[model samples]
Target chain A: MAQKVAILGAGLTKFMRRAKETGKELAFEAARMALEEANMDISEIDCVVMATAPDMFDGVHMKGDWLSDGAGAKRKPYMRSYVGGGSGVFAIIHGWYLVASGLFDTCLVVAEEKMSSCMPHPQGAFNAIYDQFLERPLGVNLLWIFSLEMMRYMHVHKISLETIALVSVKNKRNGLDHPCTQKGIAGEYTVKDILNSEVIAYPVYRLMVSPVTDAAAAIVITSEHEAKRRTDNPIWIEGVGWCLDTSYWTNRDLYYPKYVEYAARMAYDMAGIKDPRKEIHVVEPYDPFAYKELHHLEGLLLADKGEAPKLLEKGFWDRDTKDGIPSCPSGGLLGVGNPIAAAGLMKVIEIYLQLKGEAGKRQVKREVKRGLAQAWGDLMQVGTVVILSK
Target chain B: MPFKEFIEKLSKAKVQKGDIPVWHLYTLGIGGDVFYKGLKEGKIKGAYCEYCNSVILPPRMYCEDCFEKIDKFVDVKGPFIVVAYTELYRDLDDNRLDIPIKVALISVPYAKGGIIHFLNPYQEIENGDIVKPVFNKKRVGSLKDIKYFELKK
Candidate 1:
């Protein structure tokens, strides 16, 4: 039988707008933190799983290989997996499988994105996402997709702009307590501030969008036996699931996520989560866009169809709200920063911190025995989910 | 100039004036070459796979069905409808271009693919607008040779 897998340690550099550190330096800092947290030496790692969104963001090709040294691969087995924004969580799930399959005793998972290198604007990199023939010609920008989706979500759920704007306000406010959060705006915020922000796309304002960031995160995964020896509170990897939908984005429904449901089904089945809404103590759905959080909340079975917005209005997603579900207590990509791959890993790290009671000011008040983290990406075509338990 | 001064000057130049490696990023013609070439002659061209019998616009390198390479090119006079397009406020350099450019997707009939090109007269062009390619006589045999596409009506 294959061994069970557990997260030994996790580390992250302060997610920032523009760090003085080079890409390699950021990776090294995060890697060093993870290794030190594990109380293990670099040589102890058997394999390295490096996750990064695109070479364009870093202005370097084959970034996994370029970052091999900083990620601690160094001739050890290493591979790269990319499903756009889901790259980080995907990397961790891959690490889990590696350890569970008995292929490696210890694995180092690294996720990094250096958006600062994309000159003029990171938006230039987004132009490459469209189909050159069908979509590129339409002058389709990245925000348009999110805006359209948010519009559909609003229409379907009868959600007001204020309700959606609350997500941005809440996460940014919550992020103030997270030291590593890049865009954690301090002080109180109002829905009016969000409404007054520049309209990057219809229904999606500037504040609702996560800032382009440069950061790195790393996690160490080990076999169950090795984890027990390394740390007293190892977070066990209960289940992992990832799925990709068709590339023909226009043919599918934008308001709902079918792929995320498929992925959640696979993960929930494995994690014995017959009732995700009741079972999973904490949830971290991808929030590259504000509506995405609600969209994915429904997809993860955390709420009934079109009920996420209402649940949010009722304070269901609040860390201290009486409704009792803590979502994105780490402030999420909405509050922190969206460095593509690193954003997903940051979510995973949040689960780790919460389970260990290390979340400090942003910590949830409830007992978090089981938690789930998910990352969605790729023209909104990919979904990755992982369930963890202490 | 002294060897030291010459070497120093060359190294400090804006884009490796003398001895550093450089690579140019071109939308290479390997796969889309024919689709681009046909435009130079004011014609829209596409590739049809003999095996799969699929007429691929945007002149694909291989058939989506058979996955076999389709190197043959064919021409089509277009009343190609606009599928999608964007109006840009800035150029590739982040500096505003003199004329606001309308980039669009032109869906050609009887082909599996569409051509991405510039749509001139931005205010008038709308989705589903039929347009024809306009070739630049000075720059034939390349994708850029086609100056821009204009509304057919």
Candidate 2:
């Protein structure tokens, strides 16, 4: 059996639409914060694993080597891994192995994205992701696929625009409590407001989307003995799971994410959790879009298939609910700006802080022990999951 | 704080610049030849997986879910439904669009995927609206062969 691993520290930078810092600078900032919080020096990190999505975003190739120094991995054993947006949680999984295998006493994991570096519009960089010969000629941007998925999801679930809009309202409201909340609007907005917002795509309004951002986040994980020696409080990694569906997204049903379910099952099994709805206390599932929270909630099996929209109507996934659970109390990518990989890493950081009772104003009202964080990326292909317990 | 002097000194540092200047040419793979040829003939070719008894739009060589090789080609039965639509307020440069291009996701009935393209009509386009492909008089084996999908009059 692999050795147990624990998170010594976590760090996050406030998400921004644009940052003066380069990718390396952002990585260094987050890494420095994490190391400082752990009361550990950069020299102690035995290895480093960096996660960032798309070279296009940073306008750099061989991003791992370029970012290594800023991530505090200068002349240290280092590598990078990516599964598109899923890289955040996937990096955690990679770091866990480094410590769990006893090959390294500690590992520093960081995920950064700088979408602003891509010229014209960051959305244009996504053109390379499409089928060069077929889908490329359609003049499709990233939002078109999301709109297509939203339309299909609504059609299959018989979902209403009102219920979907509520997700935006509640999440943005939750954002007010999170220090990292980056939704640009200064005041409160309602479902009616969301309904009246500019319709970028039918069934998807401007309010429903997560803004592109430039940001970074980092975490330090150590072996059990090292964790005990390093800090009085160490959040335990109970389980980790990742799964990837074929990239041919057009061949799969858009209404449900079977891949996330597959990943959730693996993590839950490792955690010895047979019932996620009852066993899990908090969630920070990827929510780059408002409806995505519902979609991923179902994928996590927190709600029944097509049942999230109805339950959301009853405030089931609020930060504290008499009948249900708290989710994305950190504001999630819906309210927090999305810098792709950093957004996902921030979700993990949220869970860690919540479990540590250091979440400040965004802390859930209910007592929490175990929490789950997940990320989805690619053509809805990659699903990465991590379980943390206090 | 002498920041101005520091800035001037930093600006004098040598800088190096380079560009890849590479272009990519991608083949549509096994299933693409038939599909593009059909496009030139003003027909939308869809892949039929006999094993799954289903058809996929924008055709592929295999069924991603079932992992079955798809060798059969079929014309997507139309009166395509406008499953979704969007109006773009900004272009690639993030500038507000002058005429606000209308794009629609049109699907052949019961197909798993659909084609995303510009729509001819600017207003009153709703989900479930029946649409027909409008082909150009001059044929080219490309997506532009069909100018746009128009609501069937």
Candidate 3:
């Protein structure tokens, strides 16, 4: 049988458009903060795992090796996990494997991104991620592809633009309490404002998109016994699951994220959670785009197909609402910032902090026992899930 | 015959050629800024790591060996050693060059790392040769500011 794994501490750097620190510096800061929080030194760590998005964004080839030193890998066993944007949540899952499988007693997982290094804009990096012979010739980018998914989702569910806009309103307002949230995005906005915002791609407004950012997040994981000995409130990593679908995204239905459902089901089964809507108190689903949060909520099986938007209208996903599952209470990527892989890991750290009762102003109204953080990436083909508990 | 038919069919398939038009605007970063600025001033600089008791060339904000923040900067006025060298006979497009260009990995004294740059074409270069950097008159804070390395006279 595998040993249990738990998170001892978490850390994050401020999210912004540009950072004076290099990618290594950002990784060092987050790793240092996490080690300090865990009351441990680099020597205590048995292994190190890093997660970062495309090399194009950081402008460094073999970025994992380049960032290993700052991530506290040094002379220790080191590994880099990549799943596009889902890499953040996958980093924790990778750490869980190291500790639970008895390969390592303790692991430090760090996720970093410096999207600003990509000149003009980071979106250019997404251009090459498509099928070279087929999709690249058409000049495909993330905005149009994600806009297609958002439109299909709304068309299938009969959701209004205003309903989708609520996610932006709520997440941005929720971000107001988060100290690391990006400026301008943390302010409150009305549905009218969002609807009236510049439409970069059809059905995708400027307000609906997560801003390009640079940041890093880190977490320390250890075996059950080690965790208990180290921290008074070690958040348990109850379950971890990830799934990847076909790279040929044109063959699949964009209206739903079947990959997320598969990943979440695997996690829920391992966590012994049969009813996520009730058992899971808080969620930080990937919200790089406003509609993606609702789309992922349904994929996680917390809501029925096409029902997440209706739930939002009832204030069911608000942070302070009674009898409702608070979603994106950390402001999410939509409000906080999207540094690709770092943003995904930030969501997992938010859940870890919330379960530990350390989330000062962003805590939900209900006391939580279990929470889920899910990230989706690739050509809309990968899903990663991590379920944490007090 | 069946295999031949498959081969004939594959030859007729359409091929689409394209390129990703992505560019980068990398920041000099914490240590890079200092090193590049020093290069513009016709000097070589490295970050000093007290724990490692050595200087890091191509300066970094943190020492990879010690995994600690390094903020100390020092001038490495060196008789650099030629650790490695290669002669390039082709351009990026694989066209034959009119004359072979010489490149060498030069290691500075008291530094853990080194820089790779062009060597003087007229010089008889060899491994373990001591060299000095030649800077351009109008210098920009870039690697191009250091024109090439030549034998120490």
Candidate 4:
């Protein structure tokens, strides 16, 4: 018997490339919003788990301790868990374990990242991911990884540049409906436009990737009994899984994401999903890069391997064009913005709101009985997956 | 303004200089012996875990789960797979590098880990394309050993 875990409320600060608020302030705003939505007070939280990407992003050292007060975790059990961009999804998993384990009845999970504070360049801190004694000396930049992946997805699946560009155009257009979208642009773009756009790396264009953003998001999780007493509708955590591959990123056949597939399999098994394509109604696969959506779609078992791009060509993944499933209903990181840790949880929040029928304008037309959210991080080797149901 | 006062100030200060301690360390922990040796051998080597059966470049000493030490090294014929990468426009000092260099997450088949490498400036390599490692044998044991990877015909 599993301990019942449910999301009581969720909140987020506006996603922005740069924010005027301090890290603590941004966290406080989101935490306050979650508490308000839950109709509960900060004093009610038994445990607090804060998730933030590198402290270097904010130019602050020992960020967990520095942000304890702002997250309302001064004296409570405080901890920070990070898996790079997957930290947001991992944070909710931590909160679920706390509530399910009966150690805490209510938990406050917060994730925030301020990429703007890095002095000189945020890309500099990103360089630290490479081998200090090996890869760092080769004069490597970041775009190389995405370009390679994009090329593989294209080569293996026979996906065209035009098909990939449609994803960026679609997500950005969908973002126009989102009030919190920071990079949302209302314009017409073609595959040629993306291909011709300044090549950041071979096979990757400037418009295909998400921009660095500063933002915060929060969610409150509680036991089944508490959720029943607090809200009319509570989104339950049906399953969760996180898996990491070797840090040696260059040694694997990345044409497919085995790590993501493994994580998704663990989640699907726990959720009692036989065929994800037939069972899951919505998806929010991580889209840090345009091709990643297609890469992760297969990893999520949302479609047969290498079949996602074909579906995309048929207008299958469009928010308005639901082909058995709706994906990135909230516009995703591609459109809503990528604030590192906050972005993944925002997808979680979207699932919660859609299930509760409170997603207002960004709401999907179909009933969202069960949904999946995933985030990838850590040298392209880590994948975190979650399944939720109402 | 008195010499006695100035002398007193100088006398109270404790100033000492010491040479910065240095140790020549082989980063055999993160990147395994195959990785270091490959740099020295002028060939790219990766390891495949027997248990999890995953390929790893910049070879790992142990499988992530079994924690079993891996000793076998295999050569990679690239077109490396790109997992996730970014491009930096400027250096740490906010100054541009001589040129925009391409860094990649190249995956070697039959290896448990991926080896990150630099792409030649004039060359264009796509994800999943075969590439060959270009090594500077003299720089082996140092980070600059594997100069860059070139697209394989």
Best by TM-score: 3
Model 1 docking tier (incorrect/acceptable/medium/high): incorrect
CAPRI quality of model 2: incorrect
* Candidates arranged by lDDT, highest first: 3, 2, 1, 4
lDDT of each: 0.81, 0.84, 0.92, 0.78
Off by over 4 Å in 3: B1-5, B93-100
Model 1 chain A: ten consecutive residues of lowest lDDT: A181-190
Chain B TM, per prediction? 0.71, 0.84, 0.90, 0.67
User: Which sections of candidate 2 miss by over 4 Å?
Assistant: A183-187, B1-153
Q: List the residue pairs that clash in candidate 2.
A: none
lDDT of 2: 0.84
**TM-scores for every candidate against the unseen true structure:** 0.72, 0.71, 0.94, 0.71
> What lDDT, from 0 to 1, does candidate 1 have?
0.81
Q: In model 4, where do residues sit more than 4 Å from their true spots?
A: A183-188, B1-153
Give the TM-score (vs. native) of candidate 3.
Answer: 0.94
Q: What is the TM-score of chain A alone in each candidate?
A: 0.98, 0.98, 0.99, 0.97
Candidate 3 residue lDDT tens string, B1-153? 355554458778877878656788778789889989999999989899998799888888888777678889998888799999999999999999987899999997668999999999888999999999999999989999999999997
Clashes of each: 7, 0, 0, 29
Q: Model 4, chain B: what is the TM-score?
A: 0.67
